[model samples]
Target: MTRTGSPAGVLSIKPFRRLWIALSLSSFGDWLSILALTALAGSLTKGSAENYAIGGVLVAKLLPALIFGPLAGAVADRFDRRITMVVADIMRFALFLSIPLVGRLDWLYIATFLIEVVTLFWIPAKEATVPNLVPKDQLERANQISLTSTYGSAPVAAATFSVLALISKVLFSQPQQQANLALYINAVTFLVSAATIFSLREIPKQRGKVSVPSILKQIVAGWKFVGSTPLVRGLTIGILGAFAAGGAVIGIAKVYVKQLGGGDAAYGVVFGMVFVGMAAGMFLAPRILQEFSRRRLFGLGIIGAGVALALIGIIPNLVIVALLTALCGAGAGIAWVIGYTLIGLEVEDSVRGRTWAFLQSLVRVVLLLVVASVPFIAGVVGNHRLHLPGKNIYRFDGPNAVLLIAAVVAVIVGLVAYRHMDDRRGIPLIRDFVAALRGEHYTLEESTREHGVFIALEGGEGAGKTTQARLLSIWLRDQGFDVVMTREPGSTKMGMRLRALLLDKESSGLSSRAETLLYAADRAQHVAEVIQPALRRGAIVVTDRYIDSSLAYQGSGRELKVGEIAEVNRWATNGLVPDLTIILDVPSDIGLTRFASPADRIESEPREFHERVRRGFRALADAEPHRYLVIDGTQSQPDITRKIHDRVRAILPDPVPPSAEDETSTMPAIRD
Candidate 1:
């Protein structure tokens, strides 16, 4: 059966579920702590100094990343992830508990700095450990769940803080004491997280081999990798840009709310709305934009955020500002998930921790700069009142100016990043975006194929692919159209040699990776030498096997990641997908029985292998029914061929000559 890694399916893994729960609790605590900390900073001073004080607190929280972020990834790599997380959580618990008890601004700064230092190490370890907790197929879904839990807890945290604020009002008169209840709760959550992480045995233990030179080398290598890889570079820029936009909103939110004649409760609601939007974005992205290219999606998300932020600055109403903030959060949320998922899939385990640390470090640095400076800048610009003729007054202050400027910068960042990493360059953005909204995968019509058709027949061992291919080619040729019939693994001169080595039963001990690569190489040559050339000349290019065959036979049958295989094939074929892929579906046993000759190297595989291949085809077809035609191989040869022909005719290029159309109507039925 085809595996659908839904949210429920991913959460069903016991260890992952535990980790997710722990993360949720930890995230709730972290969000609650942020509110308490910022509120405490605001309470520490009055008037213009409040912005400065809040900026100082944020700077303290993020400054450690600049100093220690590079080494944190190496720490995750060189130590046990579980132990690292547990220890960090314990440290944070103590630090948070001391904050309210100390009741001093200096102590708050010191504790905040220390908390961030511990967190820098904890985050990399946590992010790197996640991939090991679930199956590869479920990795993306797992990330969606993890991120949802992390940010989804924000609203809960906000609600809890609001309740505590009310309780503190009745119980205590001091401003510092008002935040004490929330701080104590935050401290308790870290302890809970520590205990939960201690129980998960699934997080793989890393080698504790530590050396100064090795550490330095890894840090350098990590930087080099980020700098050298275009995809990584673009993703880093995109993610940082998204966070900068978010951070600007966060930094000014408290004071901006007050400026709109709102109090702490309104600020809490605004904060909660951002997370609500983030949660909604994470939950809905996969379903709504499932067919959209992730690269383009990431950029679009950032642009949407920038647009919303611009509006947020211009709109004066508190309720509308909150709604706009949610929209901004939604965009940032989409970009965050896609960017992280791409990194997880692209980065290897050995360097994964370091890569995450690098990204996290930059994110913190961006947040630090944005939060530390934007508020101060807003204070510098101060508030201004514009009077209208009808006795209406509009407030256009430093916050509004700052937000508009940040929005422009964010949009530019998104455009640059999009241009750097876009895979579908010639495709129109608006057309593709609309198609994605409608749940369609749109590929720009290739200019090379003036009137050509590309078709592939895919199936198991004896699914009559060869017979169908021959009959289809003859029928098309009889209609006065040029047809090039081909098959993979023996389609070209290089493929002929590859076919012998691949199919010979004596070729034992051939590794799965080697076999996959060999098939890719053959397909690469087949497309370049025969397929593309035929299609460019406006001929009907029919092939017995194509990219899908490798996806089924090697990807699913060998238990390799289908996505990895698809990526390889996509590169090999230069992103040339068939206009139509016909899968001759049949039961493995029945298909095997039809093969008269002794089984080849592939066919000789156990019955279970073929079953996987069959399921893989069905899954592929199910994913894109618009581009596939699945036929029962058990049907009469004539019946199958007629069905295939009808489907092919619908997609064929128009402007058929009058004689060709006349002959097509009178065409004889295809035979096997």
Candidate 2:
């Protein structure tokens, strides 16, 4: 079944639905356990000892990921994922149930560590299972839903803990008893998660043996692959950087709030707002910035977070700081979703588990280091009140300095990752981002309509688009179909005049925008008078030099905004985009060398201009790969023709046979 690229699509699969529910319950229970374990730790200690006990429990939760992550991932890959998850959940259920029954601080810490170790194994298995359960296009939506469920359940768990505390006070009359009840309830959630997973028999078993040497080899191979692949390496670094930024914020949030003249209540509000922003960014950013590349978006998200964090350090107002915190969280959310989606899409299944494990472990370690050191670093930095001229005072504190440093580090890391991972190299990032915001990026679906297939040929000067179009037209006619052979800028009576004006040497001084409009006007006339009419009649309309040529020459070559040029052309053509655009890619020097006669006004431009035009054509082709056929113009003419013909044949409808009467009456003779 074809799945829609929406949240509903993933939910439509029964096994995925069950798995998703299990994940939600498990995550909710995990958070509840954290609160319960901390409360238990406090009960077992007094004075300053309570703080250490609570910190130790939290640190214990993170430490196991560093130690057991690779081994857990190897086990996940070598055994049945369904059994792994179920067994892990069962162990967690028993261990969590014992945490309260045993009632010792050491036992509580040990149980927490064991729970995290079991969770490490469960996580990689679950992460590896998700992609197999959904369609490729729907992976992002699935991840979005999973992340929403994972993080979204935190507030509910917190609220549930609060309510359970109230009920325990009223019924049991002891704080320890209340904490123990919450623990018991959390253990039961694991049991429920286990039962849910047990019902999902669709989870696949491991393909290979689970020997020690094999596990070690797989782990090494996974690390080598991550180090070798540029995209994965960039993703890993960007993800870790994002986590580090978030960790710094979390680690210093309390002190930062205090510096802003706020207390625990204010800190809670800011913390909640961060998650709110995260939810907004994940749920809304993709929809708003639909046309932007995910690679660019991910990098931009990190940069945005860094910028927001820097702004927070400079601003002393608690309200502004809270808003900035939310903004930072939103950016982190976008990066998180895009990064995980890329991993699932780009990484192969063989090493997917290990890759996920490595990512998880690295994130945990970075977070651990950041959390462990930020407080110490803040203490060493100390606080100072700076006096400036004109009665101005700036109070600089440890939290502010830490945040400033984090912001710089995050921005630098983001830039490095962007340089490595950006797919659309050479295009300005700021310009693309602005264009995306202005709604100028065009989607293929928006440009195409249900009609006869329209094919366009595009290239630099003298790349033989006219020849290719003619050959394609004749081939279509020979196959017993009606074919409309045409060219833009001259196909219509009005277009001829505009084309002449555009090409004449006298128009050499025309402004770039004027030249762009002239080309768009010619396209408008050509499409209205010829292309759309033929397409509506179900004829194959093969055109030479369509919208792309204008985009290349007037936009890229002339250095005008491609998005603005595209918008004008889109309006002029009334959204009649070609079904297929075959870009005959040729080097500028080679293409220019083919024009032996005196150059036309546009062709007489510098070699640099022509090179830009050539690159522009290639860039447009790269952007919409499925709609384009980019062939080397230096290839043999017959080979090029054959390639075009094969592609056209795949999409062409069955040919209609000629009528008997029409066949009999075809006796017209040529009069010379």
Candidate 3:
């Protein structure tokens, strides 16, 4: 799906529609049951059954996943998952609609089991669909936007359904009984889900072995594939751990109302809050994935989930529980996203079928186990009818304790797995920091520097850096070099806001490190957009201040570590270094004299700080003899321009005039 071209062209793909429709419809129905299902079960049976049946039916439904998962996975792998998804939805439609008709408990049990059979295949098919729909490198963003659409729509639809159910309850004799509307509505969603699946055009299907040579062999093969890949195996194990604990938390959430506080309705809030967390996680995931390794993010998500789960047992307040549940949801959402992202990245298009199938099977089996463990754990937790310990009987009331146990285990395993993920660990750490500089190295080297140069005018507060940048731009253009000069911490949208905060005299108590970071973030955008393109087009790329400003001013003047600023700049530019640095050596008093207005925030720094900044610049210049050219900042504007022009000529012969035959060399490739 790496359809690399103009980004707008990629949105035209049809598979996106199918992905959107399926998630929206499925989640909407899932939400209705989220609050209603417990009520439905409670009405159908006595108190014991109400308690056990919810857990029981879930267990029963999930059981087939343990037995039939491999076979279903094989089917999804062998045949067209599109057809499988379509058929599965149709089956769910029939079963959900028919579930309302099943008069006996046995029939209901059978229906529950049957629906999960459909789910076993459906989950994997849906999971595998995204990479097919979007290009490879864009997968993270595509996945992000896709998940956002799903999560964003689900809540709106759920709220609509909740209101509908509430209104129907007032009109109906038995509001609990009328919850069947949700079942029928869910059934319709399945129908809609199926229609969306069917609407997509044919994709190249992956083939799987249908010959029943050995079921054990295929199962073994699936396991082998999972085990062979470091990424898949580690993440799958982590995912299983996360879900197992998460399911426990969900299963016991209703018990919190009975023992702690709130009821089945409270359970709804917990889940709804969790979903809200999903929306938030989807929004922030790109940053996490970009700045941090996938494994680290995955670990953090799990660790957060586990910690929240543990906290629920320790601090058992409804409000706190709600907050933690939301946290748990957010963590889970992040974990889920990372899982999807990793799967898409690790698995090839052809083997994606088997990979997702295997993944889905594992999830189904784990869910079933989570469901099965509930009653047994509940039985163990309750005050014994047969003299079992109260700890054993309290499983329903204290599920988080068990969840906490799971969380602790997950954290330990994740920490170990974290050590093995080597692809990203160190590179991005430095890359982000380097990117914070005004004009990074990549912006310089990649630019065909024959006709253009990126002269980043940089100095302390009231240093006349901006004026010099403009002056240099004018001089360079007159000399026949096309010049582009821009300022740091204000070039891009967020950067401008950051620039205001950094330079504002009124914004007191700003941390030096915070100031340093803001400068880095702004440089990231300028390099990506302004500097790189200009240089690439053979134009002179000049900036007001490059990374050196941060190193000299923030790093040395403000006493922040140069290393830390370097790290931030590195990440921002992907480790790009500037081709040359021309340090404007000016006494702090002379620099201040250049500004007619009162000193802005940073300009008001102590004279000692300004001295350190000037010294820091000179120190950097000394370290890199060839790259840095120091010019007297105290010189008149004309003399200053002449000196800067000489430095430009020394780097590369000054550009020919526009009227000259070589004018084409300075033509701007960049557009506003």
In order, what is each prediction's RMSD in angstroms? 10.0, 13.9, 18.7
Candidate 1 vs candidate 2: the lDDT winner is 1
lDDT of 2 by residue, 1-672 (tens): 011123446898888899999999999998778667766776576543444565567678888766675688688778889999999999999999998899889999899999999998898889888887887778888987898898898657766766676666677665556578889999999999999999998888864333222333444556765764445677888888988888777666655775687633355467666777887888788767755767777887888899999999999999999889889989888888778766764455556787876666567668888867776667677778999998999999878988998898789878877766675554566776776777555433433344477899998988989899998998889988889999877888898898899989998679998988989988888888888778777788899989888878886687666657777887888777777888888777788888769999988888878877876776566434546788888888998898888777777864542353367666433222
Q: Write the per-residue lDDT of candidate 3 for residues 596-665, one digit (tens) a residue.
A: 6787887888776787677667655543344666777776777767767777666654244445545576
TM-score of predicted structure 1: 0.65
TM-score of each: 0.65, 0.57, 0.53
Q: Model 2 Cα displacement at 99 (Å)?
A: 5.5
Best by lDDT: 1
Candidate with maximal TM-score: 1
When 2 and 3 are scored with TM-score, the better candidate is 2
lDDT of each: 0.81, 0.77, 0.65
Given candidate 1, what's the lDDT at residue 54? 74
Q: What is the lDDT of candidate 1?
A: 0.81
Error of 3 at 610 (Å): 51
